[model samples]
Target: MSIHFTVSGLTRNLFHSLGLDNQRAPRPLNPEQSLLLECYLAGQIPESAWNDYVFETPELARHVNARRSQH
Candidate 1:
């Protein structure tokens, strides 16, 4: 007999066995991060400062890049 599991099911099973199925997902941007992103998008924040901020938190970089792509 052959057994089949979908890719997602296999991933889920792996995570469950590793006790990582309950790990929290990435959160939405908080108000402060939103405001900073807005300012950066609006050209209010200098690129140097924005680069520094994004470098400090790669998650913020992802958020900013996603927002930029939407526009």
Candidate 2:
């Protein structure tokens, strides 16, 4: 049987090939969280919405903060 790779599996392989193994593993986001993140990045959401999203999705909040620090 052939092996099927998910998006994340492909991402890991790409990272490894690029010698970026030390990177933190990606966190899986639910549908709602993903949409919220997209909106936040696009500046389509308000601060109040972001605050509530952070409270509800603490893990994603940490991930977002880490990305911010990198930039």
Candidate 3:
């Protein structure tokens, strides 16, 4: 007996197992948002300011929260 697995088939199976197959793609950050997030993650931005910015930017908040959860 022999078995074969195509790259596309393996990739699709992996994504499905990880629950990423149906999840909506993450939104890309704008230039300003990207800079702010980088600063925040690097501890250059204070928590107060980051909190305020996240409150006003739902997309950024989601990104931040996801990163936090990973750690």
Candidate 4:
């Protein structure tokens, strides 16, 4: 048997493997960091929380960064 991942990159495939393809999967919002923006837009998170929540999970980091570049 074989598995077919519709995603087209190594990073993307890894993300799927990690179950972070969904928005609710608890992944980082941006790669470089969204500290100031998130704090201004929403609120601040604790230091430990930031460490826990912020990570370049799977395809999320690459995909999001790519899209941002287009704008």
- Runs of candidate 4 exceeding 4 Å displacement: 1-56
| TM-scores of all predicted structures | 0.57, 0.51, 0.56, 0.24
Query: Who is ahead in lDDT, 1 or 2?
Result: 1
Q: Once superposed on the true structure, which residue ranges of model 1 sit more than 4 Å away at CA?
A: 1-26
Give the range where candidate 3 is weakest over 10 consecutive residues by summed lDDT: 17-26
Candidate 2 global CA lDDT score: 0.74
Tens digits of per-residue lDDT for model 4, 1-71: 99766647877768668856644333445534554334523546555554444362334344434545657
Give candidate 4's error at residue 34 in angstroms: 18
**Model 3 TM-score relative to the real fold:** 0.56
Comparing 1 and 4 by lDDT, which wins? 1
Across 1-71, the per-residue lDDT of candidate 3 in tens digits comes to 99999999999989867857545445889999999998999999999998899779857766776677779
Model 3: pairs clashing at backbone N, Cα or C within 3 Å: none
On residues 18-61, what C-alpha lDDT tens digit does candidate 1 reach at each position?
A: 85643544358888888998898889999899889977764676
Worst ten in a row by lDDT for model 2: 17-26
Ranking by TM-score: 1, 3, 2, 4
lDDT of 2 by residue, 1-71 (tens): 89877999998889867747535655888888778787887799888988888777766665676567778
Question: Which candidate tops TM-score?
Answer: 1
